[model samples]
Structures are given as structure tokens and as C-alpha cells.
Target: MRTTRNNNVAISCCSSSRNLVYKIKPLSHADSKRLLFKRIFGGEESCPSNLKEASTDILRKCGGLPLAINVTSSLLATRKTEQKWNEVRSRITSAEGIGSHMKHILSMSYFYLPLYLRSCLLYLTMFPEDYEVQKECLVHRWISEGFICGKDGEDLVELGDTYFYELVNRNLIEPVEVDYNGKASSCRVHDIMLDLLIDLSNGENFSSLLSNKANLARRIRRLSLMGNEDEGIIEQLDVSHARSLGVFRPTKQLPSLMKSDVLHVLDLSGCRGLENHHVRDIGRLVQLRYLNIHGTSINELPKKIGDLEYLETLYVDPGMIVLPESVSRLKRLTRLYVGTGTKLPDVIGNMENLQELRSINPFLQSTSFPEELGKLINLRKLGIHWRTSRSVGSSYKEKLVSSLCKLENFNLRTLNISFWLDEEDDFIRDFGFPRLNSVRTIRLWVGKFCWIAKCMLSHANLQDLGIMSGKIEQQDVETAGSISTLAEFGVFPACEGPVTITSRGFQQLQEFRFTWFNGLMFEAGAMPNLKELALTIPMYMLNYSESCFDFGIQHLASLATIHVQIDCRAVKAADVAALVCVLKSMAVAHPNRPALKMRTICEEDMLPDE
Candidate 1:
């Protein structure tokens, strides 16, 4: 059973078993002050003498809540003075009750934000609790909503990223995952902070959250419905002034957008019931800047979509059958994302404002597809999926390579090229890929291992490379190792074969992963700087003779951790024990022994012999 104490807190217990309940009480005043001081200064001993007296006053009014104390500390970390601390202390003490204290503390933090950051933080309240916000998606939304401020000579996306980090630093939001480049890839709002944001948003009329009909505001600018409970209420309200509208959950049908003429954003992502008829009038929303219909059941886009000349971002699900050529009329479209297998329009080149275009299914015979792609000079990130067949002529391959060569001056940072080749097709042998020097990350899903070697030779500055569904050979491994800047490498081979690594390979590689490889042999001085290694192989491969199982992992001087996943369905208990013993012995005998972790995955039904 579960019950809500306050809207911010929930208590749960097992009713079928012994009813043992656990509750969390507020922190003590002394403990709260200690935490606040340590959080701000990184140590209590470093707390300034002048701020100690003011810190006590602040902690006393925090209602002994850790969230309040932490948010206050984050605010004070920036303003380092006795006067500033006293001001915050006075504001906290003036609050009346527990709820009032939290609101006051959070409001203080919110009010202290720069104007640009305030809108960005408030917009986050539009999302549901515990929602993992993707940094790129959020930044694009901010840009489309006019929340991001532009700096001369700086990209708008980069400026929006700075705003995101500022909110994270202020303790307004928590980071979920950071990328390898130390950039926040996703984030979430704390429950306490979310409560504060809801209140603040309502009071300021920044946005309206409708869970039921009664929660709908009469005069709202932005609206997000929690579920289908109050979906009908949308038609009853006068949403002519609504600038943004979102449906967080699936409903039977979407309310007509005929009245929302001044709308800026219409996000119906993941609404399974969305039909083409529901969006038939979407073209009337000429002012719409951002539109997302991903994961919906709409098979084809309404031709009227091109009427949205101001549309900057368009995201559609992969199930979409065709994109209307009218989309070329959206001159302001900067970021276009479609799911896999989406046939793109021929006028893609006219949208010169596109900075990111992904998952485009291009027909090799369609000369317009590649030619228009080459004209997107502003494109920074590009992803293409090509379905290759034996019938594809040599002229088509040359045209594809020539079109890609025109993009060399675009300075693209990320490139993903995947080829779904027919079983009998040997496209990898004759494919000529132009050199893209600016690409930092290159992902190739091809049929042959030689393609990986070609990519490594072409892009010496690649920091990360992922090869999938390819045949890896010894020379291919040698080619990958010689890349001076390669740091991370992952390969999912198509065939089971032995891979041998000679000395002095993978000099700068830090992480290596081999998925479904039959066997791996590392000679001395190979992968000397490798820090993390993961091997996912079948259990039958581990039953080889002891001499064939010499992994030479001890040669990895900088190795720190190794993870092994064994597919265990036909594996015998004794064979598993023997393999575990060998790994344990290697870990113990190595001069720089790495931590070893192993797990078994049941891939199939157990055999009768087992």
C-alpha cells in the first residue's frame, strides 16, 4: 500500500507481507547547517568566520529540510559576502510553515537567476516528474521557444548548452547522464524542486498543467495535460492565447487545433492514437516554430505541413511512409529528425537552414537525394541509411561518393553511415567514401571488415568508432590500432573467428568492446593504455583448450577493469567453473591485475544434457 503525506512525499509499504513502513523525517538544525556549509565550501572547516553567524540563521528557517539547505548553499556559493548571506537568511526566516519555507528557498534561487536562465528553468516544469530530459532535445526546444539568448559569433546551440549547465550548477536540476566529452546528455528535476516549479509556474502564469478538468486555467499560455482524464476539457477552454500545447500521455483523439492560430510549439510525441485526420488542420498554425509527432501512427504527413514557414524543428516517427515535398517550403527548419526507413523528399536541399538531419532513407537511384544533401552546407550532424542491392550500378556509387565529397567544407562533427546490404552484395569492396576530416565520431554499420580500415585511414582525427555486423580480420585490427587519436572502439562482428593483436597496437585506445567474437588473443604490448575491456562471447567458445585460451591480458599495463558476459544455455557447469578459475588466476598473477567481473546471460532454453 502507498499513501501521500504531502504532494512532495509518498510512503509505501507491503500489505501482503509484514507491514514494515519506513518514514523520512526532516534533518536537525545543526546537521542542516553542517551539510549546507560543507556543500558550499566542500568542507565545514573551510567555512568563513564572517558567514558562520548568517549560516545559522538560514539553517534555522530551512525547516530542517535537506533540499532547502542544499539549494540555499548552491545559491550562496556564487554570492560570497556576509551581507548577501544575511539577506538570504532574512528571507528564509520570514517564511511561515514547512511548505512555505521550501517555496521561499526555491523562489529565492529562482529569482536570483539571470533572465535568460529563469525562463529556461521554468520551462522544465512542463515535463512530468522524473522525466529524463535529453540535452539536445531540450536545447532545440529552447532555441525554438526564443528562450536561448544569442551571442555574437556563437552558435545558438552552444549558448543554450551554457544555460543548461548554469541551471545544473544552481541545484535547480540534477544531471542524469554526461557524455564522454563531459557534456550533460540528459537531466531530471528533483521532486522538491519540481513542486516549487509547479507553484511558481502557476503563480506567474508561465504554464498550466492539467491533470483533470478542474486544473485547467481559464487563460493559459502554455498547457500540458497529464493523461486522458481531462483530455476533453481542452475543447471547452478558450485556448486561443495558448502558445504551446503538449500531451504527456496517449488519448483517444487530439483536440482540434483550429483555434490555436498563434501557437509556437505543438508536441504530440508518443500519442499512439494520433491519426492523420487529427493533424489535417496543422498547416493553419503558421506561427508554429516547433512540432513533434514522433511515435504516432500517422503514416504520411499532410501536404499542408509546408505552410509552417517558421517551423524550426520537425521530428517524426519512423513509421511515416513519405514526407511531403511541401516540407521544402519550411525555410526556417534547422533540425529535422525522422525514424529509420523514412523516405525523404527530393527538395531537402532547399531547406538551407538545416543544421542536423538524421535517419534519412535515401534511394541510391534518386539523383536528387544525394545532390540536395550536398547543398546543406550548414549541416553539422548527418546520418544516412542506405539499402544496397547487387543491382545498384557503379555510377550510383560514384554519385553517392561525389555528393558526400561536397560536404567536406561543412565541418561536420558527427557522421553515421549505415548500409543494409543484400546477402550476396559486395558493396563494401567498391564503395568509395570521401574523406571527412572534421568528423570526431564515426559509426559504420557495413558488411565487410575492410570498411573499418578504410574509415580509420580516411579520418585520422576520429575519437570514437563503432563497427557493427562486419567481419574483423587481423589486418583490420592492425589498421584500427595505428590510428593515433582513436580512444574508444566497439565491434559487433558477423562471423565467429579468432582475432590476434600484435605488439604496439591501439596506442591511444582507452576502451575496447568485442561483441559475439569467437576468440581474442592479445600479444605483449598490445592495448598498453587500455583502461576498460568488455567481451561478450558464447559459452561454447570458452571450452577451448587451455593453450588456445591464453588472453595475454596481463600485457595491458594500464588495464583497470574487465567485464565478461557468457551466453549460457548449452554451457556445462564444469566448463563454466573451469573458465572462471582461469580468469581468477590471471587476475591474481598479473603485475597490474585488473578487477574482473563476470555474468551469465540465458540466451536460449537449456539443453537436455545440461
Candidate 2:
């Protein structure tokens, strides 16, 4: 049904003839005469009346409107607007191509940005291109340097998102094509943008600050000096000419910055042997923008640390024995990474410009977390690692956990937790990682039967989860089900569950494997969606089920691959036959799934029957 404004007429066009459909609204006999006059006189109105009559006769020969109506200027304006809209649409379409939108966004800062912004942008060149820059990760970085402004009442994660959008609108970063959920799937940078980063890294004109030997400096823009334990270790190098210097070392001495006053970046990760001599001269580079001392041994920071007010990133290792009161004077610092054994003063959080933070213990656990930590509204990633030993279970542990709950929603891609448990099933109750929905991978070490495996399995965003060592008891396994709801890709330590997986439950499970499980024959609905399956047979159950016939698994219709270690010596041929039958049935059901190779181990091969 179509509605018309002329009178209050509603037309049911579905039943009408297709030929008259195009002539519905604008067609009319009088309108045709007006169109002719307008085309002939060109709106000049100089045509004669006699000539107009002749034109009308010619128009009558052409197709005429179904009804007569007067011409109006409103219709003409509508058509012109439509034409301009079409042109604008075409230009937008031409500017985009396959994956170009996201690629261009990754390096948006390289194009048409101020020099200061570009200088900051080039610092990201250290990471892999197209790497997802979490809003929290960037904010934390800004906070460590005192670059970001702190607000009285701002959500940390929201602030990070706002910053990211601002950069995107400036065409310094491209927005990724995401799903309705707003998760970034992929991104890339334009070639021209990357070239600009390269130029910034190399410095505009002067030589870069790389050294051939120690104690000598050369003119350079971006300088990375390294010390290695290899036989040809270069102990000393001069970087007087470089503007940014990052050092990775296996030696003791820190390189002297000869002539450069504007050192923007300085990283000395794994420099365990660095001494006071290395940091004494650091104050000379006042323009430093980023500084990392991740794995160094210098215990005490000199009072001159305050001189580098422009520092943006600072990493201190456990080897940094003590932080001076002057450390709080570096108001410009935004991002800071602290290793274990180093104490961070409460005043560190007082710096309103601070954003990103990564701190590991020896420091955090040694002292109570200052309430001032909550004041850094600009903070993005507040990475902290603390000791979790067996005897340390208490309410204090719960406090440590609840304090971090608010920080869970931040965009973090990787999280690593290292803990030791002396008691059974005690740690899981206190462990909390609910807010890490954006983390792609997690590496955790906890005691077996901690009871948190269920929670870990249910995590919605985890693509990779590694548990160094743990066990799942049969009862706990039954409680947790077969974990068929897990994503297509997952890895974990061995699991134990006497409960069998039903066909429906296994339908979505793609990869499955475990070590040290009970010797229970998997019946027909064990693993229907199994693309790959691996299992280890228990030694004690060999004699009990050895009498049962056919040792192979059956009924896994979707099984494309199988890896099993079976104790076939005590097993009868009937068991092997049963296994073969299942395999044959699967081959018949899914012809393309194909058969798998079988590998077996015999009890005779066991060591002295031990």
C-alpha cells in the first residue's frame, strides 16, 4: 500500500499493473505541457503562444500522464538532493577497500598529525604492527609519564575508550570492522604511515646513537644498544648522538649518553649487573620520554631521578634496591613497570598524570596497597603479581582479590599468574579473574583440585589457557561436566571423569585430550564432534578390563584423528575387534572423516613390572 499526499488517498499498488507503477505519482497531462514549456523557453518565458500549441501536439504523440496536474519546484529540489547524495556515497565507497579501513587505522598517527603526537606515535613502533592496542594499555602508558590528565570522577576503562576514539577521529587510527559486540577483530596501517614511523625512528637528520664500542657516541635519531653474553660481547658503546636509546644487556656497565640531551626512550631489560654508575648519568638526559629498567640490579635510585621530569615510561626491577623520595618529583612520568623486591612509594600514585602501571611482587606484598591507588583515575593496566604460598591463606588474601575486581573490565590481552598451593582445593575459592573477559590467553599455576577449573573453562573470551600441572577428580569432573562448551581450541593438563560425554554434549567439542585417566571404555556417545582425541591408559586397570573384548574406542562418528596409549598385552582380541567395529562405523557415517593411525604400548615393555 502506498500513501499519497494529494488528497487522503491510499493506493494498493501490489494488485496494479507493473507498467503503470512507474507512472503513479508524478504523471499527469497538464504537467507534461509545463515540462515542455520549461525545456523550450529555458525558464526565460520568451516562446510564442502559437509555437507552444505546436509543441503540445508533438507531446501528445509521446506517452502522456494518466492524470493532469500542475508542475511544482519542490519536486525538482528533491531530485537534485538525491543526485548530490549519490555522488557523496560513491566517494566514500571508493576510499575503502578490502581490509583497508582497519589497516589504515593502525597507523593513523603517521598522517597529518602534529610533530609531538607523531613523536609519541612512533614509540609504538616497538610492538608488532596490527597488534591490538588495548585502551587500558595505552592509558596506563600515558599515566606512567604524566601525559594524561586525571579527572575527579572518571572510569578508568571509559577514559581509555575515549582516548582511542579521539585518535581514530583524527585519522591517526582507523576504526576496526567489528561485530555488533564492538570487539576488534583485526586492523592494519597504511604503507605511508609506517614509513613515517620509520623516519621518526631513524631521526630526521643527525646520525643515530648506536655504538661500535663502549664510551663512544655517534649522531643518530633512534638508538638501540645491546650487551650480550656471547663470546664477542661489546662491553662499552657510545650513544651521544641518539635521541632515543633502548638497551638490552648481558653485561654490567651502562652505556654513557655522550652528546644527546633529548633521550626519549631508554630500556635496559635483563641488565642484572647494572650499578650506580649506569644510573648516575641518567639524570643528564632530562628530555627522556620513556625509560625501562626491567631486569637490572641497581638497588637504589639516585636523587637525580627527579631531573627527568619529562619521562613517560619507567621500568624498575627487583634489583633496584630502593626508590628515593625524589622519585615522586618526576611529575611527567606516566607508565611504570616494577619488578619484585622494589618498593613503590604511596606518593607515586599522587602524580595526577600517571596512567599505566605494571608491578610484580617482592614490592606489592611487602607493603599494604595504599588507598591512594584508587585516585589514579587515568590508570589503564594495573598489573600486579603477589606471592601466593600454601601457608599464606587468610582474609588478607581476599582483600587482595576484591581490590582488583573493579579493574577486571579493562582491555587486557594477556595475563600471567604464578602461584604455589600447598593445600588441596583452597586457592580456587579466593582466586578471582572474572573481569578479564577481554584476555585472549591466560597462564596460571595452581594446585590440583583447586575447584576453579570449572570457572576457567567457562571463561567466554579465553582462546588459550595453560595450566602447568593439576588434576581433576572424578567427582569434580562429573560436577563440571565434560567441558564440551569450551571453544574449538583449548589445552589443559590431564583430566579425570568417569562420566561419559553424551553425543549432544560432544557435538561442539572439536579438540580433546588428557593424560592419566581411568581405564574406562568410552561407549557410543563419548565424542561426536571430536576432530582430534588423545588419551593415556591407566596401568592398574589393565588386568581388570583385560578380559573385556576389543580394546579400541567406538561410536565417535566425527573422529578424524586419534592418539591413544593402550595396554594391549593383557587385553583380548575381542576388545580390539570392538574398537575396529567403531572405527568402521565412523568411516561409514562420515566418509570424509577418514581412519586414523593406531599406536599401542604393551605391559611387557614396562620397567621390571614396577
Q: What is the C-alpha RMSD of each candidate to the true structure, in Å?
A: 4.8, 19.7
How does candidate 2 fare on TM-score? 0.47
lDDT, candidate 2, 133-226, per-residue tens: 4444444444433345548746444554555555554444445643223344333443344444544555443223233232224344555443
Candidate No. with top TM-score = 1
Worst 10 residues of 1 by lDDT: 10-19
Q: Candidate 2: misplaced stretches above 4 Å?
A: 1-218, 226-241, 252-255, 271-273, 318-325, 362-370, 386-402, 405-419, 424-444, 451-465, 474-610
Query: Worst ten-residue run, lDDT, model 2?
Result: 66-75
In order of appearance, the predictions have TM-scores of 0.83, 0.47
For candidate 1, what is the TM-score?
0.83
Model 1 whole-model lDDT (C-alpha atoms):
0.76
Instruction: Report, for every candidate in turn, its global Cα lDDT versus the true structure.
Output: 0.76, 0.50
Over 217-309, each residue of candidate 1 has an lDDT whose tens digit, in order, gives 457788787674554566676667888888778765655678788889888888888888888888999789988889887777788999998
Residue pairs of candidate 1 with colliding backbone atoms: none
